[model samples]
Target: MEVAGPSFLLLILLLLAPLSVHSTPPPYLSPAIFAADYDDMLESFRIFVYGARRTFKFKSEAESLFLASLLGSPFVTENPSEAHLFFVPFDGDLSERSVARVVRDIRADLPYWNRTLGADHFYASCDGIGFGSDRNLLELKKNSVQLSCFPGSGGRFVPHKDVALLPAGVAPAGEGEPRGLSSNETIEHLAYARLGAIKDPGLVHRLGGDPGLLIESEPSDRETFERRLAMSEFCLFDYGGDVSWIGDAMRFGCVPVVITDRPIQDLPLIDVLRWQEMAVFVGSGGGAEGVKRALRGMARERVERMRGSCVAASRHFAWNRPPQPLDAFHMVVYQLWLRRHTIRYARRDWS
Candidate 1:
């Protein structure tokens, strides 16, 4: 099952064509194909976690927790030889030098690292990988799959080769349950910010004065934030190239109103879900007036339908104790599954 050398390079080049810089709108592979092979993923997929169990749980180390989860899961194999994918549990917060050292250690200790030149290996991170040393690990960057919180048209993220790690927690620690608003109680729109300034300077000033929206720089508490999210017909998500908050909007049953100039794939689960059903897109260049026009222009009935779909899509973002079916954990696993199956190549280059 291991493909190497020139054959592996050819397969990667061919498969990555659609994900190249100049690709069209519907760029990802059909989710239906993944759905059909879901059972095969559960039945045959094997992963080798390359380290000891992590005892310390840092909030930022999602990769650590993911490795722990897989260690206890059915997909993990005791033998590395049978593993379809190898997971290098590199902490996202590691210094560039630290990252390079870890990669060097893996290369020194493991025969598998050189077999396909890390083609079937993967690492997960809550923050996007942003270090030059990390990026300079040519084999890792070129061949390995990255499971990251941010997936955009950037050097760090390669579509089809990386999976978006949905940031968990519907509300912050000690927050109230995610409750839906009654049809009559919903606000026209809601926008909240716990941290970081709005990427667009004029956006907050333009939207802050509007009585139809529950817009605030920061909510008083988690209750207030969750309440506003629940009570909104639509939640504005001004993409700053970070996707940490969008899941909360969906979790509370408010359709997301994403303002991004980039492709839809910039958001999580773009490969699997039909985003138009649950989210509204406004061009970032359109400014606040454009967002207002788009939201106010939608039919009331269509808004309700999208809200319902948004709630359904939120379940995929949930990460359970042991990991559940179709939750964030399984979704990540399925992405790795896709990589495992798709890279298989058998033809000889006779020419």
Candidate 2:
């Protein structure tokens, strides 16, 4: 009458696995609720992220990890039948089991998915992570990724492994921008500055050509982008959402002047750079125009050094060096092709 059996345990594991899988999406990604074509593919990607996260109300740490994972996911899916370039988010309650299961699903799907999506179509933007100075990534022999995005991150905390250094002469040998000015350059009509609010209008009035060229009226534009990189020896980006723009300046080779009020006391990614070594910083108490005067007053050699440092600084961090927008698309699309053409064609696993 005493019984010993493994079948029941196996049944339970099988049932639980699929149920957990079923719990993850539609609601999490909420694609059905997506309202617009989002103008561009990038916009579509953003809207998808926005709408999906909107459904959750969680603590900041959860939000950060979620974002990192979301960006890190290797399974790239765009609706196959429609021209839709975005996929719905994985809708699920944020339990440990749920998260773990989803990660499993992604790992399983990626290689097969790549085979399905045309090799040229898209690729996962998932860059593997690594430790501070460890070759953890290299040990795995993961492919090297290109840092294709913007300001190139003006912040100081990027990890050492992530930084890419420019050789000498391409960037000056030290602590500010290099020695000579590109005399052929002319400060143009759009030359301008960016900051949250300018307490002192002195530099703003001086370098900022028209009263109309206000941060509020125009916000930051391509013109502001051109101006900051072109006219000044360097640029300063701090405060909310400055990460994106700071990245842009780095991509353009302009030195970044940075200071932050945010209590990001632990972002090792921003800590790798020597802040005062190449770029300038106005403490949190210092406002916009004041920071501007600091940049404007620096000597040409200092600017060149700063520029070199900016380039040197850019070598680190996934954010400072974003992959090309096209690369993600290529990853996603290629996976889809391989899945359709090879795996499904042979494995007959799923239609």
Candidate 3:
């Protein structure tokens, strides 16, 4: 597994060549079983942020903009030489050519990209899998750490290498407080659910008569939505891998019932967070009826326990200004710290 010192540069070149693919999946280690020392991460980790200029074509760059603002933060270094990681910030829609141009710019203007062929770098995007069609973007996904909302191994995300990033504007800055029902509060509703608009019509038609569930398609204002979410015991989401809805549900003390066909790796923060404790999963194999059975079968005590865990775990999904301890921003950084050696192992010919 070790790369010889002399062949390191040659390996980097090989990784940089077009059509060169690293197919070996990274080693799998669950962070849930072990405790992460945020103190250690704070003391040892530093990142150098790339000041890439954006043309402001798209309005979906909030995540990148927020991280870009961290250039002067304690976790950031003025000198790239002393940094353990590099941050690439981009605004506007991502395309194959646009992605390639950004990397080309970095390789031409800086010396660091040559060091690891982008294995030591990372970026954030709220737009999930929309920019994944291009060859250059696929290469970037393989080598660079991609902080994205839709992280599925079958598509754009590489689990151990990439981190699940929270979408921008989901949780306001400095708003990490749990907003759901108290332990003693009377649980009035069983669940507040919304199947994605794209969900199968037959499935929705079948679940409409379930008395235990309140499935709403009517658009509600943010205030009303949160109000309803806070009252429910469980929040059902089939939003096609939108992490914001999951975060909102957890923020409101509603245990999530995620119904998806994607692999478990698609879930955000699965590397560190124990999702089974905080949320319920319903696979496509079981169909819509499986979702109902899973929710209805839970005992009151189990429901309460899961609800509490949702509140506790929601902090990791909240984005705070200046990056609060264990918050979403810090969690993403911690994931990077966990994969700091990605560069050294970048040359493995998993293909």
Candidate 4:
């Protein structure tokens, strides 16, 4: 999800040769997860999940699923000495002091911290609040992978060092099932929201007048929501924090249209996938006119190609139990694998 311009696509193309195969294959071969090599480290790479059991438990079912996926993976190790990486799982509800206490205890009890200065140690927490408050924890996190759904910028989330954790969502298709495009829905633009920024009178007055664009301020049931999204060629997503809709739109075969002024860094698969090829981006300041202009600019063939790409990429965003090859869980692991070289520990000290 690290934000870069079109040049990123070139980098992806160049690096495609090395990042195209998963560490573990066959019994768990998934192309989506198979893209970068960690210098064969993944073949023997092991992670030790430290911290108390209670500290790792999450209130959110989705967050808990992420932990379950990691614990069930083959790369986890029972002994710290066998680990290439360390994980301290903390939930969103835990306080800064609680997180700090866990890190302090781990530093004292484990030799790994002193050897690497905690560079190889990482943590996963869904919430961003209270993470920046602790100086010691902040310093440690800066050197390690801080996985989270909100990979917001500023402090601990250095794009090159951290990983963007996608929210847990239902898979678009079952294993071996065909991913069919939506044919019933015929709407061109479908948006359901109450945000004032999106509903600006001047902008809405322009785009709303068109029958092709539909914006409903009223809330709808899940069934209705899915139907609207499925029918539309483009689904409008606000610049708001919640990005659950991006996955939903892809699931239903609607190309995502992100409306934001700032550069987007935390978009799912931004590091691997060519987002400009799949999703439409419009500046918030451009108003509804911007949205209309973007849509107008796209030819029919181009829109279809984008939708095809969305369907192809949807499987990577899925949440599967037991963690399939390139499912959401593996994608998170892949992100970590991509950053393996960024945090290096002293070899002689560890040896």
Work out the TM-score per prediction: 0.77, 0.35, 0.76, 0.76
Clashing pairs in 4: 1-265, 19-35, 19-36, 20-35, 22-34, 185-231
Per-residue accuracy of model 4 over 28-65 as CA lDDT, tens digit each: 12333443342233455667887534536664555677
Taking every candidate in turn, the Cα RMSD to the unseen true structure, in Å, is 9.3, 20.6, 11.5, 7.9
Stretches of candidate 1 exceeding 4 Å from the true structure:
1-35, 54-61, 126-136, 151-153, 171-197, 341-351
Put down candidate 1 lDDT per residue, 235-277, tens digits, no spaces. 7766663456667777776777778787656467766777877
Judged by whole-model lDDT over C-alpha atoms, candidate 2 comes out at 0.34
Shift in Å, residue 186, candidate 1: 4.7
Model 2 Cα shift for residue 295 (angstroms): 3.5
Q: What is the lDDT of candidate 1?
A: 0.64
Q: Indicate the residue-level lDDT of 59 in model 3.
A: 38
Q: Please give, for residues 1-351, the per-residue lDDT of candidate 2 as tens digits.
A: 121222444423432232110121111112221111111222222111213334543332222333344444432233333222223233333443443344345335543323333211221111212222323222211222212112223342223212121111111112132122255765332223464323344534543554423243243566554444545445544533334344345434455555554443322122223455544556655554555556557786555555554443342222211232212222222222222221223334433
Kindly report which residue stretches of model 3 are placed more than 4 angstroms away from their true locations once superposed: 1-36, 52-62, 126-139, 151-154, 173-176, 195-198, 218-223, 239-243, 342-351
**Which ten-residue region of model 3 has the weakest summed lDDT?**
19-28
lDDT for 28 in candidate 3 is 19
The runs of at least 3 residues in candidate 2 whose Cα sits more than 4 Å from the true structure, single-residue gaps closed, are: 1-183, 186-191, 195-224, 261-268, 288-293, 296-299, 315-351
Please give, for residues 114-226, the per-residue lDDT of candidate 3 as tens digits: 77677788876554343455554654667788776653335666667777665554575344356546556566677776656226667777676777667777437777777
